[model samples]
Target chain A: MSYIAWIISIGNELLIGKTVNTNAAWLARKLTLLGYDVRRIITVPDNEEDEVEVFRDAIKRGVRVVISTGGLGPTFDDKTSEYLAKALNRKYVINDEALKLVIETFKLKGLELTEPRLKQAKMPEGAKPLPNPVGTAPGIWVEEDNTIIIALPGVPAEMMGIFENYVEPKLREIGPKLHFIERSITVKGVPEADLAPIIEKGMKMSNRVYIKSHPKGHEIRSPLVEIHVYVSSEDVRKAEDEINKVLDFLIFAVKEKGGEVLST
Target chain B: MSYIAWIISIGNELLIGKTVNTNAAWLARKLTLLGYDVRRIITVPDNEEDEVEVFRDAIKRGVRVVISTGGLGPTFDDKTSEYLAKALNRKYVINDEALKLVIETFKLKGLELTEPRLKQAKMPEGAKPLPNPVGTAPGIWVEEDNTIIIALPGVPAEMMGIFENYVEPKLREIGPKLHFIERSITVKGVPEADLAPIIEKGMKMSNRVYIKSHPKGHEIRSPLVEIHVYVSSEDVRKAEDEINKVLDFLIFAVKEKGGEVLST
Candidate 1:
């Protein structure tokens, strides 16, 4: 079975360019490192209809895991939790554990608890509250069948804190057992076309080998081209060995073409 | 009608976490600043199937403009141009203008032209080749109805170079008459809940006003809360004036709560 994940970033700030949606990129990188195939990422303004549509579409597309960031705060525009509840057709209530955390956080900060602040405690029925030691708003983990949806705060620091402290470990526990590895060798001074035959030969030698080139600087001026080699396999150690062998051959090929490896 | 755009980052490096997809963020910022709603961002490995699936999905979801980055290289993995052609049901052919540019680039680089390098000149039939003065791979611009799909190189410098020189001007010309402007004010000392009432009043004062809270550094024992106020309007001056009014009210409310505005 193929495992896929979808990321949703919820914020009007991101949509309007007031804030960069770093959460999606960060999560995508983490998921990739953990061997989850991130199929797509969606960013929507704080709108119930748009968020619901994205959520429903992702579910229908057979995404095994759905990670949502942002709009979990204690304001009117922060409507992700409630909207998610509505979309999932689940009842929402003030979770005691979550409320306790919120109240304790307020007391620790020497702040008065307000009604909207209390709303942070409310969550969709059956959803597990992920501890948020970094913020008053707790991350939520909702599971239906085998598909999992984790809702995290939009703040980069808070999101990272929650993911590192709880989400990452939990995901690893439930994630697949497949092992994947990638390697890159930067090449300079060689035109990409002349390098293709060599890359083709390298790929033929290693089943997992792939090459990509990126041209740097202005096209009119002198451009620097860097070629990256990627290798992935079920056995990480074997993948590394295969990649090293290919890299050695590629370096020789570059020199033959009057170019040199930028660096290994 | 609200304008919506989608960004597709096509590369294997992005999938393996070897490279950060900065192009998506940069393009998102640009599109947002231009008053275009970026609905989603999809990053797929340099696989034809995944590329076609993502492209079809984005188009089905009604994205007016789909900007694809990467996979315009002169290698076997550089199949974005071909896959995109299949997705759009168009024939792939080498355009004379693009061929000339590719040959000129190789001539200037003092590199012998090879078959794979010549493939960089091929584009979907009837597609307009966007100038790529910085690299051998030229960008392709294809339009069907009101939806526009632009394919550009993946390299950050080349992507930005082509965007600034070719894409941006064309986008502005075909884009909506809407204008976008935003301002953020950071607030500290008040919990988001206690600040909700003030935020509600601020929102009522202006239809475009929206407030979001981001919790920062919660794990360090003392957490800081940053609230951002965003306003979007078709008229720049009106938007700025309205945001200022909301800022004034927010400042008054924060001061009433014995809190302070960190920045305006």
Candidate 2:
């Protein structure tokens, strides 16, 4: 069975549309490739109440994994650590390892540790800090009865750094064994409305495979559509076979309907 | 008071990272510009149960406006309309106007209306169908007791066509009078940790103005950061004045700390 996951992206910049939320998309891609069924991608503001509420809600929903990005900074609005502790009913304390990492990072710059810099070391009691190789604020990892929550910095580079180095390996060990396979084929001269029945028949043929169409041309005139066929299953060979069978059937059906298969 | 808004982006392709949710970002930007305080952006798969659950939850949360994109198509998995009717406890029916639009679209394509294509006209009992300028599926608009829900097609061109032509004008008429102003300035040579106190002070001086710092450079070395200052108020002049005041103070503070003002 695929493990359920939710991605919480925290920042006022995202809610206000100042940022495009590429972090959520990137995480979703990684999680999906790791065989985790990402159920939700929630973007909330930097407010403590909102952050804590989402964290609690994720736990209540019993998702196996929860990954959040943003609010792991030294600014007054960066409250992910504090609010996560409140949500988990844990004491907010200074973690020794996180503090040492922060001190070492600042020491490299030939500077003394200030209060704002030290704030990066604070996390929920019993939570572990994943060392950040490129930034001061380390990624946070918290394990609960039913959920594992990981909070990373909003910075693209820092978030990617910790996720690739620390989180990916651990998740790979525990993630589901499902293998996913997908293929896309572009068709011309066939409107999506006309191709809908063919897609429906294709889906009915294989209950395991999902077929979706994206129209690239005008509906009333020249119709160009890209059909995506994908499936995930415990058996890699079965998954591949299912995808190939459905793909061949779709190509044959499209050509039978006078549609030109442009590319696969 | 700023009206609260939420954007629900629907599609499995987005969840699996096959597509980036640019539709949500575009809608959020438009809503924010129209003086709507966008609170959340939720992305869910193309499942009827999940769609209905999120729609009901948005109503329970009492957001003033909820806009959803995707799943309005001529395929089997396109269930946004059906699930929305269920969520609102309204009988799903095909309206004459919507039927006419769908028939005309098919006629333009020199084709007869099939069952799957006809399914696009079905909507809640009291809903209105926004005319689609570029696509076959008409956008669905439903007004609840305290919430307004608008469902548009998942296709980027079609969704944008309906929203820009039909929905934006009506929203402008009923939206809040607040005007939002934002300004960003880049600074170098001052770490974000050191700039945190100044940002906190700037925020304290003006409760209405929000100031956020985005670190562009590494913390230990050449520290480069961009500071965003923004505010929204009923009075356009007051909003502009407040933003300028906060921006000036932040710039002065950054320069006072020996940070080079790269650009504004």
Clashing pairs in 2: none
Measured with C-alpha atoms, the lDDT of residue B232 in candidate 1 is: 52
Q: TM-score, each model?
A: 0.91, 0.98
Worst 10-residue stretch by lDDT in candidate 1 chain A?
A215-224
Candidate 1 lDDT over residue span A1-264, tens digit each = 657988888886665555655677788888877778877666777888988887777766668889999988877888888888887889988888888888888788776677877888888888888778767789888876667888998878778889999899978877775566555566666666666788778878877666666555343344345667665456778878887888888788878878756666
Instruction: State the displacement of the C-alpha of residue B97, model 1, in Å, after optimal TM-score superposition.
Output: 2.5
lDDT tens digits by residue: candidate 2, B99-218: 999998878767888898899999999999999999899999998878999999989899999999999999999999667788899999998989999999999988889999999888
Candidate 1 per-residue C-alpha lDDT over B1-264 given as tens digits, one digit per residue, 9 for 90 to 100: 547898888876665556666788889888866667787777787888889888877767667999999998767788999999888888899889888888888788777778888888898888988878566688988886667899988877678888889998888887775676555666666666677787878889987766666555342254356767665566778878888888888888888987777776
Model 2: per-residue Cα lDDT over A234-254, one tens digit each: 898888888889899999999
Using alpha carbons, what is the TM-score of model 1?
0.91
TM-score of chain A of each: 0.91, 0.96
Misplaced by over 4 Å in model 2 are none
